[model samples]
Target chain A: MEASIRTGEKETGRKKVLISALLFMGLGHLLHLKQYLKGLFYAACEVLLLVFLPKIITGIGNLRTLGEAQPHLPIRERANSMFMLIDGIILLAVIFIFIIIYIISVRSALAAYDQTSSAGAKKTKQGLNKAFPILGLAPGVGLVVFFVIVPLIFSASVAFTNYSSPGHIPPNNTVDWVGFDNFVTLFGGDATWAGALGRVALWTVVWAALATATCYFGGMLMAVVLKESNLRIAPLFRMVFILPYAVPSVISMLVWQNLLNGTFGTLNRTLRTLGLISSPIPWLGDPWLAKFMVVLINLWAGFPYFMLLTLGSMTAIAQDIYEAALIDGANKFQVFRKVTFPIVLYQTAPLIIMSFTHNINNFGAIFFLTGGGPMVKDSTLTSAGGTDILVTWIYKLTVNLLKYNYASVLAVMIFVVLAPLAIINLRRTRSFREGEL
Target chain B: MQPKTTKVNIYTIIVLLFLTVSSLLVLYPLVYVVSAAFSPGNSIASLNIIPFGDGTTFKHFDHLFKNTNYLIWFRNTFVIAAATSICTVFIASLSAYVFSRFRFTLKKPMMMAMLILQIFPSFVGMVAIYVLLLRIGGLDTLWGLVLVYLAGNTPYNTWMVKSYLDTIPRSLDEAAIIDGASHFTTYLRIILPVAKPILIFLAIASFTAPWMDFIFPKLVLRSAHKQTLALGLFSFVTDKKNEFTNFAAGSLLVALPFILFFLASQKLLIESLGFSTVKE
Candidate 1:
């Protein structure tokens, strides 16, 4: 009788495992169907892979043959085709895994549906209880896993490889694992890496410090001036100042570019008309002046944000603080210096840091205004202007020069430079993470 | 005591007057551009604050329309911007809801990763994006540009929408669930109504970005027909025989929609700004 009981217990345990797996599989299938209705491409891919894997492989092989015979194909073209084949296969594999997971989930759900317990509707309850966590997290995790985590891994890995060139090299030329060679070359003073690094560091500091300070002070001033109880036409003034922020930076930069033209630019014309100069100011020509102009233009673009931030922060400040300051025999300047500035600064410090980081990589303003022009003399770097920030310089190197390794190296460097600042900003601005939910 | 109060008020007035005057310096370029847009001749070379030569003609606008691909550009800009804003808001809102309401294992790390990724500056990945798009047959298409914009904006918009969602209480969700309503129903009925202010703000913000974006359009949409407003304007102004007046006219035209939108939504926009700050 004891032997019989042991055999029976083992049989029930096997049944339970089978039942749970089957239920999970059924639920996953159902979810995939729902995802199909939602137009998820990956879901379709999942369905295709489950329905027919051999056909897909055959199709890819045919495409590869076609790719080989294409006329005037670059060496990298062949490599790209091969990588595409690999990527397609990987995608198919992922789809298969997804389908398998889906099937398991459905089976579990079905098992729960079938089981009987002292609790009425025990099977459905158990299935649902098992499925809830997976149902909640599967899609979200899938997306994060696929897009964010995968791309990050790929990019980080690329940093270690000599995958910069477009020409195809045999056996995974897409990512030849050079193993720290890229990093070493970057830090070893080959390819002007050190000079570029120093320049990036110097400009980052200067740009951040100046941009943040100017915008902060300027914005506070505007907010204060606009907030005066006696000031009429405050809305008009606010609108005018806020216009820079409202208008797109590209438009602003383009307009400014024209205005700064040496020959017929309104700015030069105005300066010339005022007898301030005999010739047009080479605003885009001179390195220092160009940098200065870019900063000034950025200031114009940036101040409105600070103005808005300061205005909002100011309104939040209690009116009692100012009144108390006044009662304590503090003058207007004193009240503002002690009460207003400190509160605004403390509130906006994180935002200021963010703005500073943004300026470090503000390619749009620089790219449009000068295209990082007045190209540095005698530099092998094509399309690099003296004013080129690391971001634009990377673009110049990779796109214009096709120096993928250098660009990747530079990109990794940029991240390294800004990572500390970002961490600090993220820590300080709890709202930033909280808002991400 | 009366004299002292009067003196303080006078000082305030004086300071206010000074600021008002200096503010004109900021307004001068915009005013100049507007004046230039209207001026009939190539009088932009002059520093004349007033409309100096052949004042007030619609010829520049006429020239801008007739000579350039202004209409195509306008259409492309509208299509791209509208499509990007809609897609971005839709995707961002859904993801944000998930992020906001769902307590999953990967949530914190995912959010942190997005923050870190954003810090790297998108331009660093431009080449990679370009190559990726080219491989996928997305290069030179408006949809390609839109996708790029969508991917680029997801992190920020998700953060914004999530923050907006945070202002709402979880009790609403609990009540909905107790009523046998699903998560979707709670999101649609409870969260969305409260999120209108942020939605409008984000819509306006998202709309403005693509309309003004030049670089990606320039890089990806190399065909003249696919040019956006910024690219179109850049090429127009820089093309041989600089059409200063026409450029100004095109700029003014481009600025109109945004300015009008801002005016219409000024109250809500300001409120949203305040909301973001307070929440932060």
Candidate 2:
């Protein structure tokens, strides 16, 4: 009798699983498991999906073909592939959300059948209680999907299309897929485009490196000086040092722009009054000088942050370690080199890399200070300037030049380069360790 | 900690001298901006060698209030920043609480997704965001800017809050649940109070982001009535316009309060940054 009952239970569980999997998301729970509330919720999802099915299909189809050309119609009345592409991506996001719900429904059915837990009001309460996390996460995840993910997908899609201005703008024209063409043009196909890409990419890397290093070392120097000094008014100086960082960067950059303006800026005016130079210097008007000034100005705006960070990390270093180093016959400089520097670097290595990435996209520092101006001799062809890094160049391309395809290609390259660094960063953070929390 | 010395050492003298020179380098522009704001002219050209700029006047402030859309821009930016702050805090904290306290199958993948999202250059999607907002009637609207900021804020902030929340003892949560508290009630009454520091940091960070940001507002908002402080003040110094004094006055007004806030909250901000970024 026991064997027979076990067999019957096994067959019933299989039946419920099959029903939930094959027929509908909630049929097993509704018909056999007595989980009426949970089943109804799942069933409602299915109903919603069915209602939107035709729209979803067409949206995805439009995404694939972009859109059919309607050349006979007026420009204002013609089909817009860009709109269709965006709408299709949004629809795809919705479908993914539905699929996630469907999986959850199936899993819940399996669990309920396995446990043979017949439902009541109390069981429904437990079910809702178990779903608290999902409910909490739903709104944020939903917004990210639509706003972040959809936009991201749409932009990435642009890399594979011919979506520039003049001839290909929507209504006047329709975009079509041209796989690898933008990338090829950037890499080697066109001499000007290829050269622009090489120069911008090289400058971007060099700029990130120099920016990260200068701020890091400059801040470290100030932090060490402050720690070692016994100045009477050090607190006052510390506050002063932080002023550059505290003031809004936009304000600071604009101020610097005015101060360094070759013609009428206060810096040049003050210098001339003091008899420093016969003529005004083009601090930002000359390409090489502009690049140098960019790094220097970025140092001014950026170092205080690292200074504060270093100070915080230094304070956390143990007094015993310093005492031990001193006891080992090491002088102050030796102690710093051997113990303090290593400790601080270990603590802040991740942040240093993070800052590197930040500087790579430091659009404001370049854009506001120079407006990516004093254009290089050949940079006008690509609409980028001497000081334009990859990001600012991308900005110029999309916003100023209407070169969507090329901008998207650069954006993709940024992703390809940065994703691995982010993963490495994730691995470094102990809090991000899998199953740790 | 060093032995008290009556004599000032050469090392200390050098350090102080270096600091003074650097501080002046940092201070000159600020002083110049302030002097320009009050100077009796509209250009930086007339200013003297001293940053005091001949004399002081309130004309720029007067002009800022009466002749321009400064107040409207202020109101618009204030609204967008406040909305973004409140929504980011609530939504990020809610999701963080789940990631902290709950164990679901998708939890790891979701966490990983958040990190990967940061790898993408956010503004690359500017075209899509523009179109999306246009379709939803968010263009030229403050709320549309808020949505974009809130979306951008969610991923990294969720991780930061989650890291902070992890430091809060799980036993307290278990005790609440044992006392028959629902998950949300525990989150509201127990977790939020303890997580106040990180949340404050997040709030301040998000609040200040819109003030410094010049790019997105320029893209999303077109109407003169809807411009932000950054965009409006930027207009004063652009190639087409040169109201440098007006720009200076406006910027000083914005920067003064921010500087004060940063000074007051320095410790809280630094500590919170350390908490979120550093592992034990």
Candidate 3:
């Protein structure tokens, strides 16, 4: 926001405007002997951007060639160009932002000149006095820039290259710009990447949907059972049930992973001791069982969250709605369906959507519990664990298999898939709306 | 009007029984894990889901304290968590203060960016982060981990803290500023104290995150000495030797603080959860 300080109540003369238009953008402010700090700030910005242009242009030039011409060049030179290309993109974004600020600053300076020249006597401080908000924001913005922004741009750029498998990593074998070859490989049904992606995509969707739906309805049902009935200790039961959620998810998932661990697991041991089973089940080693166990563990870890959420809202439902329904002779089920459930659903729908998208990227459920495994051996696919969602697949591709480019492609794809959800979630949520801050 | 003629039905009995059975089922794994921690044996090879099965021992815990770098990992996790918490609370509250008080051009877009920028699962950036940290010589360190935690916790934490601040009336700010107090001083002396509850919650949340985080630390910190409590305990079970009892002991130690905190903050937890759904 631009704050213009006025000294008087009259407009500035054309001479100051001409000086500002001709000498420099903000020179008119100094010509009027008004808004000196604002004018100086604008002047400094123009000079800085002007000075900074060449490096950005150099980066852009390097980005254009992008080392393709010098393919036969040494690894060091090739990687240098790649660095230049990526850094160029980030620089361009920065320059774009700077341009926006420059325009705002210059506009504010001109406006300040007009006002201050007219007012003539009583002047107020402007430019630096209001920089406090920005100063407050500086640390968080700096952190976000380095951690989230830079890494994101870097990852998105990787999807355009061939930085996969053994030979293409940097230094040992300089990663190169492949120009959407990775995307083509991923989506073009190449036996290696496509088969795994296809299976993984199906399982990912199924897992996300099943995990979200089951947890939501499961929690809703549990809450209904506990709350609808004349239960005195419902809060006690609810707290006990939510123990799974209150516990750190990583710990719970790991505990469950071992609890269902086929041979030495308590599940098997207890079942056997009870004479319910003669042999151990391959709870986590079989593909189907592992997938099932993944969902089961997620539900155990996830439902209590929904239960707690639904129960809280449930209690807040106005008694009038229930009374009105019951006065019309509606049965308990009808009263719930028409009144109670809808109100609760309205309250929880956004959360359910958020939970669905959250479950889509749920790394811990599969990562800690199953590690996206019992490996899918149907094809020669490398890292497609039986239960690997898009997220964990991205993980396995990067950490375990060194398929950085392929993983980056999957990462971007996951973004494309989830962006809509994010947008909707933001649009619907209280946090992202107007007047929120 | 009360339905005083109500009779107990099978549905009620079934629901009651269902709740109890499900409660036990849910508690089953937790009970087993706790039992294993105290049970004498390492593996569930000989133990049942009961306390002091075959005479439990504190030997595994003693070994963890004496042999392994468990204490160091605990210290490391605490340092990282506390640093992350304090830094996140301070930084986020500062930003939140700015956001809550000031109106600006980029404010809307910045909020949107905060929301959408986090859409991509963070693991996507893992390799890039790995490379970035490697290039900057930030790998295998706690400071780098803390930095990442701060970045990761910023968006919603800022929003949350801001919302908390938004509830404080603007009249206070105006009065303080009119009383010759700068915006910065008013924020420090008045707004922050008013928003103490949310700040505390945000700090505790940020603290607990790194204490239990597995992925980022697992990637960034490679050395055994640099491993977090999460990576350390995960390796306890994931190792070829499979130190199950030790993993249990480590996990119990790891969970005790959080569970205690959760219990202490139960009202705040429920209140926050309630606010999220009903806030609309």
Candidate 4:
């Protein structure tokens, strides 16, 4: 680069060579176009990137133990004692980012060389024009990868390790890879885990399906009744219904929690005062009632969403379909069954599926209302309450019990169970599938 | 338009009565809570079905205002919610711009990554976030909660907004580029105005998040002073029972703004949901 003659358009062959040489960072600028300073900077970047390669490998290696050995090691021997896992992830992420940077550098340097040779100019400064996308994408992507993706990877890794209660906590205690022991414990005949998993998993499915069904059909029934009866004040009815949905769910649920509280809740107190019952009912402290209350409270918050969704889709259904059905001698019920119901269902099927999935992870309502209540007295479960869904159960396990390994295993299990349903629901929708870009 | 084949009879009367009862049932909680807020007595037991039970007074509201850090919690919630809204909109807009407009090398993979990231529920990564916050000393801080809230919302919001943006004609972008504007300029000037509805919708949706959110804020914020409205109000009832009236009053006060804000944005919110519903 230093001694070469200035290259120009006639050096298209040199530009092609430089483009190919872009694989080695500044080689394009150095050998094809004489730009010594820029070439050296690119070379330094390449060297620095190479320096991060071993760090990535070591990070992956250290992922197995998560640096538990640091606690057992001598003071002088402790390496990355704090945030060994974090350090590893940061190193690996830096390596990943540097690779991307390397690709950009190589491509940009090659473009500069190509333009220098194309325009017969010895120097080219493409300037900040190319920096726009990078600048725009940096903050969003950085925060997402750091805060979201990194934690996800940690969870994924922890799923394979023994980072649970007792002997496996970090810092004071060391956590090591226990292979599929947690999964085995969960899946095997371990009474506490398996019983809890089976019970909660079954309820989760029932809750999700029932929540969606009750909300959905209830909404549909309401819409049909209003549409059929020719209610002039339908908007007013609709407004009243939508109030529960519009209010932030946490406030509504918490309000309901107090309303339904067993001892002194307004419902129990009012009922007792009215001589409806001889004694106060433990509405949330009883298992069956707690489950019923979870669904019932969730319904109060959930049904309106379906009502609106059904109403919107119902508006899209052609009145002509009903007219056609009517002309075919279809009764009112027949018209609804054959015409209105199917069209509404077809349009809102994806949403119904999504709502089910949402209800599965509908953490706030269940967690806030019951805190997964009615702890079973003689059950084989630990940390989980009767009304607890898988999500809240996982929460109790992690935060309350410090069963990180079991929680992570449960997390992975949840991902396995729900991710497919979610992906299928997402892809089944027309809008997303039809979107080309 | 011609025939009235079905006659109204007992079923019609039953239907009307049933509908009225259902509506009343839906309105029951609000009426009861509103009454409790204004109830003269200082306990949940005294919360009668009547609208202004015993006598109407503002003492609970007064207690909430004077004796507690309700204002600080309100201030913190507003600050967090507002910051989250603005940040989510701005960041999601930019990310969605690249996603919608420009085709890059990682475009497909990035899209897939975001989609997959979104599908995996947030609790799967909950522990990692807690650990990360602890390591970075983000625990018990408002900014830390904001950061978490922003990250948690980014993928889904970005994808939703991007799908909406994709519906805009590419010809607009082409014309702007032909007019010698940068891509960012076109995105900022030409595209943003058109995307105003969804942006406002996103802002409102996110603005309401921290106000109502219990779990994440509960996890990230620990101290009394750092508590958001959700956590502070939760603490009132999560323990012993004497603060029931106070909790009801606080919930009423907290919900007043939200109820108003929500009613105002009700149509817009539904419209946005319907719009994003198209994306599954």
Candidate 5:
């Protein structure tokens, strides 16, 4: 960067060599570009990172080892491998971000140097205007990195570890990297784990599909019906229907759980009193029945939002479409099939897919309603039941059974399966496709 | 306008009949909850089939407030929910403004990342969050819970609000800047006030999310004193306890205001969803 002008073209070549050789991030800016503040900030970051280099290295090393096994120490005094793993994750994330900053600094400095056709004629000022986006984004991005990304990395790391309960909980015993053992166990290595996983995974797909389809079509039907009915009290009906969606899901699920309780429940009591049946039907007490009921109850709680959404999209369709279809000698059903339904579907397909992913992870519907109950006939999976989707299964495994490794595997699976669907949804969005406003 | 049909068609009649039955099904549990909250006995079995036919009492309400940690739970949940909402809006709006108005090196990738981040289930990181909270002393602390909520709050809400903000012409900000307004000032006085509808939707959404979230609170908050509405109320109705009436009473207290909030904001919520979806 401090290369004397032996020749103008040759000087540029020499400066590039010196800057890359020195590996000083801001040297080009300091010596050639004369952007002092920019230079200072870049140099400061490099120095700060250098200051913390050993700690960062130790973090990566700790993540690799989890923690030193202290068999001689008592349980309470032992190293917590979980804590070490998380700390390592945080450090790694910090390093990753620092790398991005480093690259930006070096690139900007080089770009500025290259633009200096005349020396010191165009020094880049670090204006507040240029700093606005970075300043504005810092706090939110910081929260996300620590709170979201670090935790995500930790969970993903747990999937590769032996970090479950009883035998593997930290402080009692240090967790070791198992590396796809859990994945293998669930995927096919262990019969019981594999069978339970296959059944649950299949049911998860079925549940999400059924839940999404039923709610969508059901809500669509209601919206169309309400639109066609021309009923004066339609607004009242809309309000009533919206109750399920408006009420908090936990409360709604709890109320439904009690109402559907096998014994002493109002529904069964009424049925019994009316001599509808001699035996109380095990609405939630039977496995298949519980699966059926979960979808049905979800339909009740979910439809209104779709109904509203459908209605909104419906309004956006110009009145002329319906009139044109009618003029073309189409019946009401034909008109809807040809025009209304397709339009609404086109407009709301993203949301419908979103709902599918939502249902896939809809823990409350299964968790609070049946608590993933009415265990399957041959299920060796103590944490998962017939109604349990992957998300709820993960929850039970984590909270109840302390099967953190298996739970994280399910979490990873859910991410793999669902993230693509979400990405597809994102791709379909106009804002995303167009790239920016 | 065409004159109203003097006679009801069979299709209309059939639809009405169907709506009537479904309405009853929808109303039944709601009616039951209201009845259970007021019924004299602690057990649902003792209540009459017809709502309030068994004669109502205030004992469950009295029990919920007096005998339980209902008030403390309410305070904890309210604090957490409010903080999450306010912080989510502030953080999301600020970043959203940058995303909407600025063209920068990392802008596209950051926006895309925001969109993608919204889709990953936050609880997928349950073990990590638990460990992280443990390390940071956030476990059982309301601020800790708020921090977790705020983290999850950023990505989607930022994208949603950014899209909303994008619709507002940059001409206003430019006009203000031309009039000697700073970027932050233009955002504070010009953009935010104009973007009230979306901001309100974001606030209400983030607020209501934590109220019904049983899982994270269950993981984070261990003490009864730090329990949220979902956690504390859940305790009364777990397998070991059968305080259904108290749960019902407590839920009604939570649900009634929530229902009102939803009703009042239903249009906004629907409109926001509609806007986002129909953008294509």
Candidate 6:
């Protein structure tokens, strides 16, 4: 009786597998026919080979030798060609693997559908069913891998290569694989390298620190005022304060630029009219003042966001905490210090860190406001201003100087510097997942 | 008791007075710009509160219209922003729905990967993007700028939508399934309707992202005709010295719709944010 019951179950499983296999096979055939009409006959041939004829092709073609044969190619050229060849091979491998998986799936489906009496066929069909969703994730995963991940890998690789000029182009442009030559140059007590990097780093750290703190406090003040119970025009204040955020940064920067214009700006003119100063301040021309002005403008652009965030977080706190404090004879300031400050800090620590990182790499504000301005003479640092941050410096290197390889190196360095701060922020925000999921 | 009540009233009055004064300081610059946008012969250098100094006129607006490619920039911005908002909300919500509803094996890893990617400042890969886009013939195109913005905004939008979806009960999905509704149909008929507030919030947020973003547009849209409002306004002011008034007027034109949108949707915005940050 037990054997009969088991045989019945096996028959049912076999039937299910057989149906799925036939369906997949039919779909594959349709796709092949469609491809043929689209003139992808070679690709279709490859697909069929992957699906039905598994052993015809043994090894994938090497892409490197396809380049024009030159025995005396430059090291940089050869290295570049080799990298491309490896990349092409990897791409081919991916296509090959995909076709193989599709073929195996369709074939398993077909076999399971055809062999209704085989219990093993039923097991294979169940396994494929379990693996199907992973197949579905292929497109998104493929996009990120090819576009973001692969490029990142290449950029990181370029940091170790001496591939800067026409000397690095393939054939003639063979890159000598100099492991960490660029990094060593950057860190090896070379005055030029050390000086440029040191200056940019100093400015970035100072600017980020000041921007983050000022914005945080400014935003907190706005939030506290808006949250006041007796504040009658709170909504208007919110709108006014938040207007800076609503406007694009470029526009805000331009408007401020006009306001700070040495000859015609409202700010300078107003100061003069008020008899505060006899002359216009060279807001963008002077190095120290330029840095200060940029930070102040960033403060304007950045504070509103933090204000909105703090306001949102503030409303989330339980009213009873404040109420309980009031009932215990605590004044408004005491209740705020005990309840409001800690709650906002704890809840918004992650956001504050994010704000810091953002300010650190803030390219747009710097680019628009000053263009890292008042270019210094006798500086080997191409396109760097007295106030140039690392990012703008990298932009200057690549765009202005056409030093793609070195710029790529700097880009990697920037990522290395910023990624740790990002990780810490991520961990803090991860707790919010509990609130979400 | 009466005397105490009077004292409390005075305290409230003083606080209100202080707030009113602070509000004036905050609002003055914006109001000054708006009035200047309408005021003719308005020495932009003047900090005059009253419009009586030079009298009000629409000449700056007219100047803005004639002197710049204002209409083209406005059209491009509208098209890009509208399309980006639609595309972002649709793709993000679809992905968010999958993450929120499904019990897939790779879901956790996928979410974690997205989160990690979000933390990396996108400028880190700016050079790579520029090279890639150049190769693909996407440079100097609004479409290229759109793609860049879309890629940058997706992870955040996805998380936002997913958080919204989490607030919805699983029982609703179960009920739909029991009634023989497919997952797609269940999402369309049941979940989307209920998730309207979030959908609108995401739409507004997405729209504002491309609308307010200047960096990618500055990088990608090189041609004047293809320039979005932000880039167009920047070039209009900086490329010429005398168009500063026109720049102010153009800024007003650009800021108006967003300000209106925010004002109109304040309640929904607050609700969506409140729901998103609400503790489980």
lDDT of each: 0.67, 0.86, 0.77, 0.78, 0.84, 0.67
The CAPRI category of model 5 is medium
DockQ of 4: 0.59
TM-score of 5: 0.94
lDDT of 3 by residue, A1-437 (tens): 12332222233354556556455755756666566676677678778877878887878876665544345667566545446545666676677667666565555555655555567555665545567887798798878877888788888988987776686655435556778787777775577677788888888889989999989989888878877877677767877877887788888888888888887887888788789999998899899988887887788888888887887887778788888888899999998798878998989887888788888888888888988888667433567878888998888878878888888888888888888888887877665466463
Error of 2 at A25 (Å): 1.6
CA shift of A11, model 3, Å: 8.0
Off by over 4 Å in 2: A1-4, A117-127, A432-437, B1-8
Backbone Cα, N, C clashes tallied per candidate = 22, 0, 5, 0, 0, 16
Clashes in model 2: which pairs? none
Q: Which candidate is the best by lDDT?
A: 2
Answer with 4 or 5, whichever has the higher TM-score: 5
- Best-to-worst order by lDDT is 2, 5, 4, 3, 1, 6
Once superposed on the true structure, which residue ranges of model 4 sit more than 4 Å away at CA?
A1-23, A29-64, A68-82, A107-126, A319-329, A377-381, A429-437, B1-6, B9-11, B49-51, B278-280
- Pitting candidate 4 against candidate 6, the one with the higher TM-score is 4
Candidate 2 positional error at B43, Å: 2.0
Q: Compared with the true structure, what per-residue lDDT tens digits does model 2 show for residues B205-250?
A: 9999998998789889999999999999999999886788899999
TM-score against native, each model: 0.82, 0.97, 0.90, 0.90, 0.94, 0.80
Report the C-alpha lDDT of model 1 over A127-169, residue by residue, as the tens digit. 3332344454454445434434334444554566565555533
- Restricting to chain A, the TM-score for each candidate equals 0.72, 0.95, 0.86, 0.83, 0.92, 0.72
Candidate 3 segments exceeding 4 Å error: A1-58, A61-86, A126-128, A326-331, A378-380, A429-437, B1-6, B9-12, B46-51, B163-169
B73-190: candidate 1 lDDT, tens digit per residue: 9999999989988876666777777777776444677677666666655555564466556667899999988877777777767777886787788887789878876666666787
Return the TM-score for candidate 4, rounded to 2 decimals: 0.90
DockQ of all candidate complexes: 0.44, 0.70, 0.61, 0.59, 0.69, 0.36
Model 6 TM-score is 0.80
Error of 4 at A111 (Å): 6.1
- CAPRI rating of model 1: acceptable
Where does candidate 1 stray beyond 4 Å?
A1-77, A81-120, A123-179, A191-193, A378-382, A429-437, B1-6, B9-17, B41-54, B239-241
